[model samples]
Target chain A: MTQSDLTILSNREIATSVYEMKLGGNTISIARPGQFIDLKLDGFFLRRPFSVCDLENDVLTIIYKVVGRGTEHMSSLTAGSVLDALIGLGNGYETSTSGASPLLIGGGAGVPPLFMLAKALVSQGKSVTAVLGFNTAEDVFYKGEFEGICSRVIITTADGSCGIRGLVTDALTEAGDYSYVYTCGPEQMLKAVWSKINTSGQFSFEERMGCGFGACMGCSCETLCGAKRICSDGPVLYKEEIKWPTPA
Target chain B: MADTRVTLCGITLDNPVIPASGTFGYGYEFAKLYDINCLGTFSFKGTTVLPRFGNPTPRIAETPSGMLNAVGLQNPGVDAVISYELPRLKEVFFKPVIANISGFSIDEYVQIAAVLDKEVQVGWIELNVSCPNVHGGGAAFGTTPDSAARVTGAVRRVTKKPLIVKLSPNVADIAGIAKSCECAGADAISLINTLLGMRIDIKKRSPLLANKTGGLSGRAIFPVALRMVYQVYEAVRIPIIGMGGVAGTEDVLEMMLAGATAVGIGSANLVDPFICRDIINSLPAEMDKYGISRLSDIIGGAH
Candidate 1:
């Protein structure tokens, strides 16, 4: 990972509490789709890790939800602001694992990384289906962006305020057969998807991390393979290796 | 150029900037980012007799100028560390690495120490009595003089390498515990480990971390660390390795002046991966600015 000062090209609200930020700098380190960047925000001790939404030469795009103080501060940043970021953290998705037909599902903020994944899958001559899940129609984002990249895009809102009602699982059932499934969302949603999906896929986990790299073992999760660091060994873990603990 | 070398228990380090345990994982991970051999040496992750899965999720919380972590000594155990991690560490870091070992019981501590003492790569055994994340043995032994000495004496019997007892700052009389460890035959002392601290989520009306509490470290705890280091230095004749909130060259010099033979860079590593390197590189320049010629000359200089 390379740490560089990235100038904010734009930080604009796209959905209710969600924002789309475009950063300009050396994007060479961000070599893969699912890799993330840790941003050192003003007045915060720990850097916030955000997944790469899209990349274009020298520019990097990330979508963040204003959940806590860090993202709240990020939402207020103007175009000219510079952010010190450790770029290209965590092992990105292994796109070679994707077969002829791949199903990509994302929930809320988890949708950002899948956007890049969908683009990569489509570019490789793979037929990709994108499913975006949100709490409501008002909270939805990137439907048009997903449509521009993937062959088909499905939007799911819990309150039946959007395309398919219920959840991403509901949309997954309607999306039909696929050779591979790649998903990222809340743990509960990811586990639900893991139980329902039959194909081998990769799941990106979100954990409270100390260092967004492997240095700090703060974000370790026990998998079938062993105790793996969620920040480095993953933000992405293969479905087979995941050992979800019995709910406490 | 100013002499940055300092000897800890007769072992001379190239510099005094040792990255604290849990921040620099096995040295190879950071070696992937930059050359780690430039460091005096780094303390490897806290290891135990058995592999640990650590605590549940949301194990970290960001405070004002620090962060609270409840990582719970997540490691692949001592055996794996010796068989796998250390061999990998040897590839990137040629310098002797400090082994930070933690356990829930005295026997467990002794067992881990006995095994690590035989390893030629281990320059020092940092017996961690200060870890606050675990329930039974960690900070419990550190808070009291008797228990601290008990663990220190037990591990000291088996280990031939320099035994540095890592002290917790959560105790009421930290000096008393340091003196006890020194009496129990500890070769040196390293203080202060992260302070026990907590934060609550206002909206959720619950603790921010899943573990409810965690050890706090970073810039917020520097003064507290310096005071404890100073106090411990007075209490014991053993050389002290000062840490907690050591971010830059200035903090390093100040820690040395506070009676640290060497200063450990902890939470700062998480902030910038190259922090230890940056601090080491800037030391000579910083010393020139402060009219100091040798770093070793400043140890307990404030006294």
Candidate 2:
């Protein structure tokens, strides 16, 4: 990973408590769609990890929710504010492994990484289907953005305020069959998608991380192939190897 | 023109800047970023007899100028480390690497030590007596002088390699514990491990980390680590590898003067992946500013 002072080009709230931030920096290291960037916020001891939502030459975009003190601090910053960030962290999704038809599913904050993944899959000439999930209509974002790139877009809300009523899994019956599935969201949502999906796919898992890189084993998870670090071996894991934790 | 080499437990390191365990993985990971051979040597991840999955999610909590982690010594079992991790490490890192071993029981510690002692690349075995995340073993042996010495003595018997007992800072008398390990035949000592600390999420009215508490390390703990290293230096004659929030060249110099024969860079690695390399690269110029010619000459100079 490379550390650089990235200038914030824009910081604006797109949805309820959700924000879209654009940063200007050397975007050379951000080589993959599912890769993330870790920001060194002032006064905080650890750097905060955010997935790359979109990347253009010298520009990076990320979406974050105001969940904690760090993101809250991030929302307070304006354009031209500089952030010390470690770019191109974690193993991103392997697009080369995608089949002829691929499905992308995202839930809440997890939708950011899928945006980039959808773009990459579409650019490869593969038929891509995007499924976006949120709790309510006000919480939904990037619907128009996904419509521009993906072949089909399915939006799901639990409150029935928008699109289909119920969770992402509730809308999957109408999403048609796919050769591969890629998804990221909360554990419950991921488990539901993993159980309902028909084909082998890649699932990106999130854990509270220390160093967004492999150095810290703080985000380690147990899998069929021994213990793997979520930051390195994944944020993305294939369907075959994932072993879900027994519910408490 | 300055000599950066400092010998730890009879093994001479190219420099005194060794990346601390848990922060540097098995060396191969960082070796991909920069030439890790520039480092004195790095202590690999804390190893145990049985493979560990570590603590639950939200294992990390941020503090001012520091972070607390309850990673609870997550490592593939010693067998996998020796068979898989070390072989890959050997290809990238040519120098003798320090092996950091942690266990839940005395026998487990001895068993792990005995296995690693036979590895040719392991220059020193850093016996972690103060891992705060685990339940029964780790810090329990470190908080008291008696148990610290007992674990030290048991492991010291099976390993012919230099045995360095890592001390925890979350103790009543850190120096006493250091002296106890020294008296129990520890070849050297390394301190201070992360301090026990916690943080609360006010809105949720719950602990930030699922583990509830973790060991604090980074720039915030440097002064506390320096004081403990100084106190331990006065109490024992064995060589000391000082670490606890050591980030830059200045911190490295200060740690050596406070009685560190060598230094370990911990939390700083999380902040910057290339920090150890940066510190090593900047040491000579910084050393020149302080009018020091030989890096080893400053060890315990403050005393």
lDDT of each: 0.93, 0.92
- In candidate 2, list every pair of residues with a backbone clash: none
Cα-based lDDT at residue B231, candidate 1: 90
User: Which stretches in model 2 have alpha-carbon errors above 4 Å?
Assistant: none
Q: Retained native contacts per candidate, as fractions?
A: 0.87, 0.81
| Number of the top-ranking candidate, with DockQ as the measure | 1
Interface RMSD (Å) of candidate 2? 1.2
**Model 2 TM-score on a 0 to 1 scale:** 0.96
lDDT of 1 at B210: 85
lDDT of 2 by residue, A1-248 (tens): 78889999999999999999999988788889999999988888788889999997788999999987889999999999999998888889999888988999999999999999988998899999989999999999999999999989999999999999899999887899888999999989999999999898999999988888888898888899988889988889999999998875
TM-scores, one per candidate? 0.98, 0.96
Which 10-residue span in candidate 2 chain A carries the lowest summed lDDT?
A40-49
* DockQ, candidate no. 2: 0.76
